[model samples]
Target: MSDAIEWVAVDWGTSNLRAWGMSVAGAPISSATSDKGMGKLERGQYPQALQDVVRELGVEDGRHLDVLVCGMAGARQGWIEAPYLEAPTDLRGLAQSSVRPDVPGSTLSVSILPGVCQKRGGENVMRGEETQLLGLASTQQGYEGLVCMPGTHSKWAYLRDTHIGQFSTAMTGEVFEVLRTHSVLRHSLTGENDGAARDAGFGTGASDGLARPQDLLGQLFRVRAASLLSGRDSSWCAGYLSGLLIGTEVAAHLDDIGEAAVPLIGSTSLCALYATVLSMAGKDGRPVDATSVAIAGLSAARQQLA
Candidate 1:
């Protein structure tokens, strides 16, 4: 492999497809994205959408487009299904298991990284974020630690010796979305943007009524009643709702894992909110950018191809 090959790395998810051209040293040269994420594209159009992106960038020669992909693109419904590596898999093992894209008649050489899964008893499975977690472990020091990645479904990963130990996922964000947008709670929640109200709301919800995990459903409904019975501002309910879900997730996982300063890999705002909630629960938290980690990870993986 050449030391200075130009390549593209893709982080294609449910809602967005992002591509970056980087030097062999892993520095990004140019980037482009499209709304052609997996959720919106038809099965047959996947190749064309990818082709369009490459063509727009004038990367027709396969030699110039050494594409590495991660995220939902590795799912069963994606361009090609990359099988999940079991718990305790390292970057070397992950790289060996990557699935190459079969874009017929196209010159672009592509490899989609498989998602990692770890079983923690029962039928629970953790995917997608595990790869990001491994990517984090690959670059950052202190690989043996717990990592909390917040998203539609938040993931808590345990890493040891550069391999995944066990992890769990919580449907916190999805439940929050459903309650706020579809349930009776929507009636109490105003779309108003008030920082003071949000802070107070989050603080109140974060402290009260998170002791019992099973009570989350009931507590969510109370947000509606609290607004109506006490003339609670609806706008504040959004923050309350956020706090409730986060609180439940934290409560469920924190004690079992013991308190260690977990590195959070996600957006800045999300990490900040999570940090705030963790602080409320008396756990130390640090936030790291998953985007930068994604780029770094792809670069690390690309080194294998080189």
Candidate 2:
């Protein structure tokens, strides 16, 4: 049993759930994950699922432990609905909107945090990235700038001194997955995508996409043509496609990024890829660990409740 564990921090998303054993000083002593996520669990199974993950800590003897959770756990279809907090709001407001679910006889005291939403010119909602933004804000000490959290549905958020001003999302990853697996382009792909050849292809495609974004349609079709005509390797094609999508996403929002270095939070590989795009545009990209930020954000929210 972890005697030093003051509370538990969880990041429950669509594909997996990660739980951290945190000390009172905000340090993590142990961590574990479950493949069972919001996508797999029913509305009533959340408590048992989460309860099992942290059961080793021995909190079942009437000594209920505080559990701070972010992400899809707060989704409408998840454990309990913690309505989204609007943008241009302070990060502290996230904890304030947290809802405690009735877990019956569970040994955990859970508070699911509210995600952030943009309701103005566009309609978008994020259930997990908000905690990451809060985590980034906590570390940077009043962080103000644009943050890029790239994934299946990448997020670009603007922050003004720890407050979420506004944000946008891109379906680039989902589109890429669909086209690669279900489209005609699937036949053109062969070989494992990696190494120098892939990078070269990515560079060329990213530069082209950034230069002439309007011709993106024509360029996408060229991937198939290149494979048939020049017998281009599937790895290169994959890299090129990734570069094209990432470049296009970045180019369209170039004006909004300003001249300041944009912070890329989340996956190191994905953030590094975004950093490459930013570099080509004469801007710097600062990479921040997604896990660390999420954990810290949970700690901050927990502290607020304390």
lDDT of 1 by residue, 1-306 (tens): 232437777888888788777775678766778899988877778888877765555454555466788888888877788888877667546666889877887767788888877554544454456557656866775656778898788988777746777677888889888877888888888667888888778877766535655688678776888787887786678878888788788877667455667788888888888888788777888898887778877777666656
Clashes in each model (backbone N, CA, C under 3 Å)?
2, 0
Tens digits of lDDT, candidate 2, 155-193: 999987678887899898898899889888888766776
Clashing pairs in 2: none
TM match of model 1 to true structure:
0.91
